[model samples]
Structure formats: C-alpha cells, structure tokens
Target chain A: MRDEAVLRHSNIWRPETIEDIQTKAELGRYRIRGFSALRSRVLPSFDDLTFIPCTLTRVPLEGYREKCSTKTVLGTRFAKKPLELDIPIMVTGMSYGALSYNAKVALARAATQAGTSTTTGDGGMLMAERENSRVLIYEVLPSRYGMNVHHLRMANAIELTVGQGAKPGTGGLLLESKVSDEIAAMRDLPAGVDQRSPCRHPDWLGPDDMILKIEELREATDWQVPIFVKMGASRVYDDVTLAAKAGADVVVVDGMEGGTGASPDLLMDHTGIPTLAAVCEARAALEDMGLYGEVQLIIAGGIRSGPDAAKALALGADAVYVGTAALIALNCNKPIYVEDYHKLGTEPYACHHCHTGRCPVGITTQDPELVKRLDIDEGAERVVNFFHAMTLEIQMLARACGKADVHDLEPEDLRALTLEASMITGLPLVGTNVVFAGGPGWKKSTHR
Target chain B: MVRQVECTGKTTREINQEIRRLIGDGEQEIVVLRPQARHNLGVAVLQPVKLVFEGSVGYYCAGMADGPSVEIRGSAGWGVAEGMMSGTVIIEQNAGNSAAASIRGGTVVVRGSASARAGIAMKGGTLIIQGNCGYMTGFMMQKGTIIVCGDAGEALGDSMYEGRIFVGGSIAEFGNDAVIQELTPEDREFLTSTLTQYGITSARPFQKVVAGRRLWRFDKKEFATWREAL
Candidate 1:
C-alpha cells in the first residue's frame, strides 16, 4: 500500500513554488529572468477568438484569387511625413545592447526587405542598423543612453517610451556579464558594471509636461517625422487617453505578455494586463475621445502568428509590433546549441536564461564568441520568410471573411470561443446571437 | 546683424520659426521681446548665434540646441537648456528645478540660486550654480563637473557614476555611493577659473564628491551596499 502522505500534496506548496522559495532564501534577492512571463494559469488570449467566415448569408470573396490589401498608414495627424507600410507588421524596439550586433543588423535588413519599419531600443541607434534599414524608428527611452541630436534628425520616426510591458514600473536591467566595454561606452557607464536604467524621464514628469516634450522633438526634427508615444499596458483606457492628449501622432500599447531582455521574474508575471484586454480598452479610450482613426494605434506583446496580427488589426490596431516572435523566427530556442543550453542549466525550447547573457542562439548576448554563431544574412532571410508567411495568413483569413482590405475585417467577423474571451472582447459566444458581456464602453453595431 | 523678434501675438511655434528664419537669413544676434515666460523659446537653433531673452522664459528654454549662446535676463522655469549639444546658457536669476538636465556639451550657468535636481544625469559639460541649490543636486551624474558656490541641499551627487561635484558650502547629506574626496590642485584651478568666467566668487574651500565605485558590480559579500543600491 502506498503512503497517503506521499500521494497528498498541498496545492499551495507545489514543487516549483517550493524551489522558488528555497532559491530566494539562498540568494537574498528576487529572481531576475528574460523573455516573457511563465505563468501556469492561462490568461484570455487571441486563441480564444475565431473568425466566422462568410457563407450563404454573406458573399465571400475567392480566397485564392481575391486581393486583400494590407497597406497601413501611421502618424498622419501632425507629421509632415507619415510612415506608410506595405504590410501591417513592424519590428518592435529591441536595443542593440540587449541584442548582439548581428541580430540588430539582421532585424533591420529583414524589416527593410519586408517594406516595413524596425525600431531602435534603449541604447542609441547603431550606425549599421541605420545603413541597413529603409525606415528606422528611433526610440527615446528613459535612460537616454547615447542620445544625440544628429542621430535624432536621421530617424524616419521617433518613439517616446514611458515604460515597457515586461516591467512597467521599473527601468531596464543589464547584468554585469552583458556590460562589455563597447556596451558600457555606448551607455556611458563603467565596464563590467550592473546597469539599471532610470524609470522616469530626466526632464518631463507628467502628461502636462509631455506636450512640450513632444513639441521639442518636433522642433528638433523640423516636424518632418511622426512622434509615437509608447507605454506599458496598465490602466490602458486612461493611459491611452493621456498619451493621445499629449500630442502623440501614434500611441503604442504594449501588453503584459511583452518580452524583455532582463527583468525581475516577479514583475514579469505579475504586472500589467494581457494583450487581449489591453487592445479593447485602448480602442474604447480612443473612440471615446473621438480620435480613433485620427490617432493611429499599434498593439504589441505576445503576437506570434498571422491570426494574432489579423485579430489585432480587426480590433482597431493600425499596425502590430512583433519582438519575441521575430526572435523565435531567427532561431531563439531552436535545438542547435544543446551543449550551451545545458551549460546554462536549461534545455532548448525551455530556456529563459537571457539574463545570464550567455544566449545559446547568440541573439541576446554581448559575447563576441557567441555572437559569431549567428549569420546576419541567413538570419535576415529567415525573418523575411516568416514575415511573408504571416502576411499570407492574414490575407487568407481576411479574404475568407469577404474583406477586400484587411482593415475591413471588423469585430463583427469574430466570435469568442470562451466565456471569458466573450466578455473581454464584447463579442458573441460561438453559436449565440447575444453577447454575455459588453466590454468597457463597447458599442454594438448591427450586422450589414 | 541684430534682429528683434516680438513674442506677444505669435504662438510658440511661430516664435521658434521666426528665430530659425532670422538665423537662416544671416542674423547673428536675435533679441526676443515681450518675454512673457513662454516655453520652448529658441529651441533647436543649430547655428552659432546669440539669443537674448528680454525677460523670463518657461520650460525647456533653448533645449536641444546644437550651437547657440542663450542669455535669460529674468528667472527661468524647469529644464532650462536641457539636452544642449554645444553652447552656453546663462540664467541671471533664480532658476527652477532640473536646470541644465542631461546636457551633453557646453556650460550652463545659473547666477542665482537653483531648485531641486540641478544638473541631474549630466553626460558632459559644466553646471555652475552661484548660490545655494536644492536637494539631489548632481544625481546620477555620469561624466562632468558641477560647481556650486554656495551650500547644497540633501543627497548631493547621489548614485553618481564618473563625475566630480565641488560644493563650496555645507552639504546637507551625501547620497548613496557618494564619498568625499580630497580636492586636487587641478580641481582648485578649474573652480577658480570657472567662477571668474561666470563672474561668481566663493569664500570657502570646496569639497569634492565622487562615486565610491562599490555599486559597480554585484557581490554577495557586499550585501549591505547592494541592498541600498538596488
């Protein structure tokens, strides 16, 4: 007979939780990690919603023959030159310090090839990235590392970053292992030091001050490029309104599932709302303020596939920014370097050791030896293929729903597969004509 | 050539545009009148010209300019001459918080007392305060010199990376990772020359504060320092 004590385990004191407690006790500090959160409890996601393709009730376009336009335009409100893209997909800001030189150049090349844009992250713009990119969006993060006015004039667009979704309330963290001499020089910090960026901008404090800040950027750029205000998705409704009111040409909302190079594990899992809910609230806030189409919206965080991008577009995003998914396409966790992954005390496909700065794939490390493993041209080709595939998927879904243009695929074409998703999206449940819960200020329009 | 631009009827954008236009037209010295504490005056003037604000200006006056010498005759608001690449900004009277914040190059001189967070996150350049400054002066300073001719408030040079702060008068408190260092001959010479150039004189010897370098890397043994630094 088996012992009853061995069979009965307390739910609160699971093995993982026990390990975490023991590890913290020994370390005397919170665990720092990389990548997105690893929450066991599932949150409402894009997978919980499915499109209802047109049938006899509605005339469907030929999926194979009909053209579905995916063209997207952003920052048209006050910018003399707005960002126009052939597709709705853009690469999000991943800093040069967080990513290797090869990875940054490859992303830039791929973005240029795909007729979209790539953004510079916390660290200042790399010269090679500028040379490779056709349209580059320079991010002015809180740290202001390597901030130069000459470089600011070279950008096609500017993103004023308040906070990222991974660790909303805190600044960025680069462990000592990643603070190489070159990285240190770029960031103006000492070599081999642990760098923690400040959470607040040095000059501006609140939205009232931000209006002048935006004007300053405009004056610096000669009002040539669009100004985008990016924020972590918490209190999405109020924050979106504030950003729009602050004279932002574009508002980018990064949800809780957003990826990071390094952050405290507790903050990654516990902070910010999910992308599914953030998009809804962001749309409601814009529509409430009567600035829905006038002020372009870009949704980010945990967007992996074409279906996810398509859903974001239908939910009112002018475009979508992909980070971790793009990294995955460049072989972030592929089983090529099993030995290195093992050395980091993890295996491929389950490795979250980016904070250690010994990235097996060379995508997120500063080590010269590891960085040699990634071939820039080859990585760029793979990312371009992935972008093409994702675009095809979005077009296929839009054509199946009788949409000539992908932006025409509205909320009416979607039905929630779960009760929570139904409530979150304000859409009807599958095989039901009634919506159980209308999302915050979500107006229901009659089907045509 | 000297040009006069009035700020009474025009918007901030128009005033800045007029400044740019006059600069482009080879006007070397431009005088701004009405001087009703407007924000963002003479912003991004890349040319090496002179801007004289007849009176007080609001936030971010002469911010992000590459090459320009700006003189404010009256008091100024927050972030005066922030992110300036090259040039000189002289404030005649009491200045608001965060004056000369995150400037990369050039010198910012506040003739009168300044408020909190003066010279915060200074990448390079010199910040001179003729009178007493408020709390957290020279916080997170990376590389530069900050000379305060009078007493400084609490937490001077907090978490500084690689900069030198010289306070002529008493310091309320020192910030984390900040330690008092003996002033070198070079420090004394720089202080004397810079004060004379800015037309300020000091009575007492100055104290130099620098980063302790304890918070540079993480160590399990230095848990006490890490606790506060983190």
Candidate 2:
C-alpha cells in the first residue's frame, strides 16, 4: 500500500554507496581524491554558535570610533622572539611542491603585507618565499623533505608536524604527474615518480623521544625561534598535553576539514575530528596542565571567514590559521577557467582535483603554462584584501561583544545553537541555563 | 691573511655571524679554530670561499653550502653537508648518521667511515666515502652517486629511485626494492672518475645498486601487481 515514489531508496545501501562499493570491487582499490572530509555529515561547528553581544549591562564599542586591537603574540613561554602579528589570523602550512611557485610567492607577499606570518610547508623553504615573507614558519615533517639546518635558522618558528588533519594516521602523496623537476629536486625524489612521505618521524617513536628531539632542534636553532608541535585533531587532549610537556612553545591543531594536495578519499572522509571539537579539547588539555596561555594554540581546518576565526578564539584558541580560504581568495576556482576545469573533469566550486597536478587556476600545479595564469601582484593583492576583510569582521564581532582586545573575548561570549555544539565546545546552550556536562560547567572534568 | 673565527667560548650564533660578516666582506680564506664540536659551521653560506675547521664539528656542519668549500679536519656529527646546493665539503674524519642527506648538487668526501643512512635522499650530488658505510646507505636516494670504498652494511640501498651506488667492498645486505645491477661502462667511468677525484685507490670490484624498477609507477588497474610484488 506504500507509494513507490515515496520510498526511493534505503539509507543503508544508498545509490552512491552502492556505486562506491561496486567501483571498489571492480578496481580492487580504494578511491583516491583531494580535499578533506567532504562527506555530508552534520558536524557541529562555529556555525552552531551564536555570540552573545553586549546589551544594557555592558556597553558595546562603536564600530568606527572605538579602538579595538587585533594584535596577537605567540610563543611567549620559551622563545627569545615570539611572533608578533597585526591580526590573529595566519597562513597555514602549504608546501611549495603541492602549490605552484607563483602561488607560494603570492601567499608570502600577501602575508607580509598583512603583517602576519606564512609557513613553509612540507618541501622546505622556497627562495622566493623566503625573500618575500617577512615572517615565516618552517615546518619539519616526517619526510624531512628539503630540510636543512640553514633553513631551520632562517625561520621565525619551527613547526614539527606530527600529523595532518586530512589523513591523520596516513602519509601524504605527491603523484608522479605532479613531480616536476623542481618539485623532485626540492623533495629529493626522482622526476615523474610518486612520492610517499612517511606517517611518523624516523627519529621519534613517542613523547619520550620527542622531548629529546625538541631539545636538539631548540639547541640547533640557538633557542632564538619558537618550536611548535602541529597535530591532527585525533586525541587532541593527550597530544596537546604531551607537546606542552615536551617544551613546545606553541601547539597547532588541524581538524578534519583541512585540505590536502592528495589523499585517499576514504581517509579524508573518515579520519580526525572537526575543528569545533578540536579547539575545545586542546584548550582543556592546556588548562589541565596550567599551560593554556603559556603555550599558544592555533587552530585550522575549514576556517572560512571572520566569524569562524572569532569563534575559535572564543573557544580558547589564541590564533587561527587558514589554507583553503586563502587559496580561494586568490581565485582558485573562478569562472574564467571553466575550459581548463572541464579538461580536468571538474568545474568551479566543486573542484577537488588538486592531486592531478593540472590545476585549472594555476594554484597547485608545477606546469609552467598553467602557472603563468596567476599574476603574482594581483594574487598577492587579493590575499591581502581577504585577510583585511576577515580581520575587519573579527574586530566587528569583538567590538559588538564589548571587548577592547580580541583576546579578551572568552567562552562566555558564545552560546551554542545546538546541543551537540554545546557539548563539544562546553559552551552554554542558547536561551538555556543548562551548562552541558562534558562542557565548561563540569568542574570535575578536565575541560573546566 | 685568512680571516679567523674562534669557537672556544663563543656560541654558534656568534661564530656564524663572524663568518657571515667575513664572507660578506669578500674574505676568501677563513679559518675556524677550537670548534670543540660546535654545530652548524659555515651553514647556508653562498659565497665562494674556503673554510677550514681546526677541530671536530657537530651536527649539520656546512649545511646548505651554495658555493663555498668547507674542510673539516676531524669527525662530524649527524646530517653533515645536508642539503648542500652546490659546493664542496671535505670531512677528513668519520661522519655520523645521515651524512650528505638530501644534498642537491655538491661533492661531499668523507675520508673516514660513515654511519647509517648516508647519502639519504641525495639529489644530483656526489658522495665519496673512503671507509665503510653502515646500514641503509643511499636509502631512498634519488638522482645521485654514492661510492663507498669499504664494505657496506645491511640494506645497501633501500627503495632508491634513479640513483647509482658503487660499493667497492663486500655488501652485507640489500633492502626492499633495491637490487644489484651489472656495472655498465657509464657507471664504471663515473665510479672511476669519482674515486680518482677523492684519491681513493681500491682494488676491490665495485657492485652497482639501483631501484628495482617495480615502484616507478603505480597503475590503478594493476594495483596488486605492483604493491604486492614489491
């Protein structure tokens, strides 16, 4: 008696699920794709949090006249010179090999203009990036690709990347097509060969060994630069605590929605927690050890706008890092490259073919022809504009919350729209007195 | 007169600054005295100068040397001559693990024995070790030549790609995806010229090692054929 049209398909074996299973059976392999955690899941995020703006009890700062400072400092605990920024936003680590040289240059130039730091990702420091970036964070990953002591000294900070959010338990992949001569040279791999970076550092097996490694690196750098430990958002509480105990000046947490150049589609969708949950865990871990503000926390992954950045800060993150958003601001998937997009078997706004090394907009490719499509000046200007816009939005939010400084905004300034968000962030539910048990109200829990 | 910098009580930063200052002033000949195992000597120096270290050095000695010539009279610690773009680093004594790692283009001559993972990930560089090399020499090497005058330890060349290794002495082991290939005329010439340049006279036959050509490419259709076979 049921209508056939109403009962389209069962949830267990949906059409796409069936197609994926059939494809796996035929190819005898899992799907490989770019971008991270794109599966349709209603994960609680900043969107589920609404700011409690100042009212009669507190006076709100005027948007134009009031002086609200966005200046932020990181690595104060153990670094001789901590990173000072005009804004709390930073450019996350994106390797030169994964991104075109032009794109790297643009990012460096833009970050410099914004008075914020840009990070040197997996494949070491590019000459152009070093020359253009006023402040640069050098990442030392498991692969040790293009790593050298000289470059280590050249950095403002050293980010020891234990894992990435996209593929926490897995390594990275630079397929053969993307392995151009320059990329190959930088990574010390053969031209036209797939490069697989290791999942864990060769020198360190656990936190005990990591402590020694951190000391070694610190001594090598003359204790001038800060040491940051970046971990994927799995076991954030334990990992952050260990990193802090190991003398890390800063801890960076990347969530599931972080982008990658190339990763198995299965891993992207299945691994790691969301950015919303990650910040809360990291903060709780730091606070438990009485090292929350002493060791700055920077969170990334799916940070799209000013609101997202503000939300992260409210959840106890000192700063926020952006990657995909910065790339998009530089015109990653604009309508002009529709023809190139079609050639890559994708289109604007839905493109995830960064692994192909044939990026339509020239952001992720090493191909010279496609690389030239992005003008460095225009791209840098656009990135600067994006940072400005995002910072403006953050200041507005902070002002409306009646905070003179961006860092003054606390968890009390926010309320979760959903119970899930309230539980994750430990913030109070909107229009409710209930302080959820796994959240900030539970004094016995480490989250308090 | 050669510009001299002493590292007796000075920190690495002071020594580095003095070296940079001397190099910036176009001092071609520099002498470092009382190194006392100080690390990062002559690091990232791009000038075409000659630097002579009086004593043993620590980790990353002469790293990222672009065009300078660095001579270490004594032993060195880990990662010596790492990522040298172009230049010459002569270690007259022994070297620790990961020597000449990821070197792009340069000539690194280790007169004494080398520990594990020597010449790891070397790209377009030449590493000549007069003595034995420990396990995993030339591990994951790419587009370079590594020559050992003495015996090679376990995993002679593991997972290498497009690089050539010449072991003048007996080999103990070979790692995954690494196999011994017949010494070709080109390889013989390269080995001979490299050995002669480093003043290494060896009567033992040299065996060539290269990637097994199994992991050169990955085919989705032939997944098991490649992954499992390797």
Candidate 3:
C-alpha cells in the first residue's frame, strides 16, 4: 500500500536482518516462523529447467546404469585422499544440542547409506555419526561447545563455521528444553537452560588468527583432515577470497534462504546475500584467483531439490550442502504429523525450533518419549532415499546437458533477470557487459 | 638400575616415548624424576599407562589422555587434561586455568586448589580438589562431577548441566541453569563411592548441584532472530 512496501517487495535489498522475515508459511494456519519462503520471489532458480540435448553440437553420454562414473571428490584441494563421496548431496550440520540424538543418528546413517559425507554440528562428534559416516566432517564454532581436542584430531574434515545465513554474528543457543542427559553431555552444558555459544572463537580473533588456528588444528591432528571454512553469505567475494588465502581447503557459503535450527526471526528473513548471488560471487573470486578448481565451493541455504543442486553446480559450486532438504527427507513437513506440530506450539514442518527439541515428528526434542518416536533406521532410510533420488535427478539433468561430469555444468547455461542479482552476484549478465567475467566488480587484490 | 627416567631435560616427545616404553613393557607404575616447564604438550598422545612426574609441568600437561594416571608432584600449567579421553591425572600441587577441562571420562584430582576458570567447559568425568578453587570453576561445564574440599572463589559452576558439583565449602555464585539442591542419600552414597574410587580421603560434607533440564529447539516464535553460523 505504501512506496516503502513496494520498494521492499520489488527490490532484493531489504536491509532487514533475517530475523524480521515472516514467511506467512501456513502449516494449515499456524504460520511457520524463522525461515524465508523457499518458493516465493520472482527470480527463477533456473530458466526452462532445461538441459541441452546431446547432439553433434553436444554429445550426451548414456548414464551408466552399470558404470557411468558418479563418484564426487570433496576436500580434494587440501586432503591427501580427498573423499570419494558416492553422491553430490551433503548432509549439513544440525547440532546435537538443537536436535535429538536420534535425529543426528539418522542423518549420519542416511548420509552413509547414500555414500555421502555427514557433517557434525557444534555439539561435537556423535558416536553414531562417527561410526555410520564413511567421511565425517567436524564443525568448529565459536562456543567450542562439545569440541574435544581428541575428537578434533579424529575428524576426517574440519569446518570452521564463521556464520550461518539465518543468523550472522550471533551465537548458537540450545534452550533449556532440548538439554537432555545426552545433549547436555555432548555440549557440556546443563539441561533446560540456554547454552549460548559465543559468536567469536576465543582463540581466533580475525582472518589472520583464523589462518593460524587452521595450522594449529592441522598440526594438532597431524594434518590428517582437510580444513573447511564456512560463512554466512554477506560479503561473498571478500570472504571467499580471504578464506582461500586463509588456507581453507573448502569454502562453504550459506545464502539468505538458508535454514537454521533456531535463530531470531529478524535474522532468518534478512541478512546475507541470496544463494544464487553468493555462489556466483564465490565462484568468480575463486576462478579469478585460479583457485576455483583448486579450492572447492560448497553452497547451502534453501537448497531443497535436484534442480536446485543442478543450479548450484551450474553456478560453479563443486558440491551442495543440504540442511532443510535433509530435514525434509527426515519427514520435516510430512503431512502425517499435523497433530504433532500442534502439540509443539507450531505446525508440522513449520516448527523449525530444531532449537526447541519438542518436535512431535520426533525429529527435534529432548523428551525421552518424543525422541523415541524417531526411529534412526527408518529415518535414515528416508534420508538415503531422498539423496538417491536427487542424485538420479541431477544425473538425469547432466545427461540431458550432454555433460559427463558435474563440473561441466557452467554458468553459460544460466540466465538471471534481476539487476539486483547482477550486482549482488558480481556475475556477468548473460550476453551483456553490465557485468563480465573477472567482472568490473572484482575487489582489488588486497591480500597479494 | 634405578630405571629413573629424568624428564627434566627431555622434550615432551622423548619423555612420552619413555613413558610408553615402560608402560608397554608391563610396568604397572613408573617414576618421572622431573620435567621442564611445558613438559607435555601431547604427553600421553593416546597411551593410558599410569605415570608419575616428580616436578612441575607446563601447558596441556595431560591433554588427550586415552587412559593413564599422570601425576605431577608440583604445580601444573594451563589447559591441563584438555579433552582427556579416559583414566586419571593427579596434581599434588596447584593448577592453572582450565584444569581437567573437557574430559570425556576418568578422574582428575588436584590435592590443592585450582586456579581461575578451573574445569572450564568440562564434558564428563570427575574433578576432585582437596582445597579451594578459583573463579568460574566449571564454566560452561556439562555432564560430569566436580568436588571441591574448600570454597569456590567466584561464580562456581557457571552454565553447568546434568552433572553434579559437590563442594564442601561455600560457593561465591552459580551460573545459569545451575542451582543448589539437597544432597540426597543416593548423592551422598555416590559421592562417597566416587571419592573412594579416587582415594580422596576428605572429611567435610559435600554439597550437590545440577543443571535444570531444558533445551532450545528451532521453532517459529522464540529465537526467531537469533542468527546461526551456517
């Protein structure tokens, strides 16, 4: 009704922290809070969702029902072995403090079943996660919650979490409700109280200190793990470049639509660049520095489907990290638990408290009874199936593009309609010079 | 042969190698004559053999112990027993910050009081202090037990959970979620048994404390704006 509302709606730059976003996402009326609408907005994840048919111009390979190579390598730039993940989909970090132990267990099992890596959240290494996951990446956050020096040594990979898309420069809080004996033990916090993780790491002050922290962990672990640094997608190019300079083996950038277990509503709806903008900036930065192939880019936030994975790969992400998607696989919004949603003070799928742990789906809760409702075996199977389907779909699209590998999916195949997107992503507008590769927007090399 | 291993001049790696050799050779106990400052950066990298050091050691003295009884005759340094896996570490003298912090299992006994921030961010296991402890003892500590024979300096057991803190002396303050509770007979029995397990012969009564049970989950209303690091 007002000019401000029109401008806000028309423009991508809301200047709002994610906290203010109200999805108006009705789970049959009890609107889900704390998340940006994944489906809204005019920007298409991709156009035509089309794949160029294999022809004389582009030769398609029949996906080996038997032998077409599908193995993906992660942390290749830093790790000696570089994980040979069976699929491209990754299970993102969901803390043991925020979600039930069984939920974490299911995620690990599911990822393992799908032959992909599962990341451990701030709650440290889960025994189930460690045993189930073939390749396990450990997350190191500001709070040092549940971070054990020994486990750090044992981690297959280590991710230094700088910020989340939903909540940036803010701490992680596991409310009093989720703290069970196990959760408390994992995070080393008392149950039924807010376990707030500091926003800044105690020992690491800035990017420079973060570099040394990387070396310290590498030395401590005898250089066994590939180190990954993740951040909310605010200053994408600068952050990605700095991360690469800081010796990150992989850079994980989570965009605005990224989901969180628990964050202020103001932060969830606002803050950070969109996923499309972020992936483009990070890719350009890496490619400009000749670190594109050398340093892997993993994108997160609001990735929910195979086509989304394809869009990310086309945008130059080596792999995709799925958070909300995996939760969905774990029956996050399954229609069956409409009743459970009400009991937890929200609607099924809309109840993201993953911070509350009272999830009736048995996904997020510390209550022994609620936790018991989740069967790791069953839940894990669902996750595995979801990954399998997404991979198949991605491969199908890749085959349509006449591409043999995921890396072949290029930005030339993509188109962006919004001026805000062009500015935010730092990407060359398709067939236009408003933006160019190694674009005019490329930040000056301050590090070199 | 006294088999007296003098660590006073040896590096951590060299001293630890000797400790491993003796323990691996079936020596139930071994004596470490002395140690230089900062003696054990990764002293017992993973060996759980019982050990005794005659003199003071420095930072991370007993860090990451898989299973071992590492005892120092003199005071110890910062981050003692950082994330120690199992077994026991004893300090006959005082200790610096973060004593027995983040231990997954086992026990750490300090005959004297611990310095400031003792057991900060501790995970599991038992910490026994024969004397008083410094400020913010057990800060952000979760799932374990801490016993103090003397008064807590300030803000004892800040942000503690699940585990119990039994202090014979007065506590200056308590952290969020941490509250003093009546020591039940079961608690007394457990404390007594736990003390016996560590051979802690103390006469004062122990007070039991615990973290209130609650959890924060992701949902619509609360923490809607609290940003999370992706």
On TM-score, the leading prediction is 1
Q: Using DockQ as the measure, name the better of candidate 1 and candidate 2.
A: 1
Ranking by DockQ: 1, 2, 3
Question: Per TM-score, what order, best first?
Answer: 1, 2, 3
Residues B1-230 of candidate 3: C-alpha lDDT, one tens digit per residue: 22457766676556666766676677766777857654344444466555777788776677667777787889887667766778888898898777886677788889888987777656678888889999878766666788898998778766665677888988888766578889998888888897787777778777777765432233444334332221
Task: Sort candidate 2 into its docking category.
Answer: incorrect
Number of the top-ranking candidate, with DockQ as the measure: 1
lDDT score of residue B219 within candidate 3: 40
For candidate 1, write residues B151-228 as lDDT tens digits. Answer: 999999888888899998999999889999999898889899988987788879899999998777667554332332
Q: lDDT (CA) for every model shown?
A: 0.89, 0.85, 0.71
lDDT at residue A80 of model 2 (Cα atoms):
93
Instruction: State the lDDT at A120 in candidate 3.
Output: 89
Please, what are the lDDT tens digits per residue for candidate 2 over residues A5-86? 8878978899978877876766665666676677977777899999999999888899777999999999999889999999
Error of 1 at A195 (Å): 0.7
Please give, for residues A1-448, the per-residue lDDT of candidate 3 as tens digits: 5587555433454533232234233111222233353434444344423344556876676865523345777777756656678777898888876677788889988888888888888777887778888878989887677777667766788899998876777777566566677776566554555566767554335787577556555545655578899998888888998999999999999888888766655566556767877787788788768897889889887888888888788777888999888877877767675776665556764556465566777776778898787889999999888888898888877776677776677755544444554554444564564643343233432223
Which candidate leads the pack in lDDT? 1
Q: Model 1, A1-448: lDDT tens per residue? A: 9998789777999888888887777667787879998999987899999999999878888888988898989999999999999899999999988999999999999999999999999988899999999999999888888888888999999999999888897899888888889988887788878888888888888999999899889988878999999999898988999999999999999999999999989988999999988888888888888899999999999999999999988888889999999998888999998999887778889988777788999999999999998999999999999999999999999998999998888898898899888888888899886687777524532211
Taken in order, the candidates have interface RMSDs of: 5.2, 6.4, 8.2
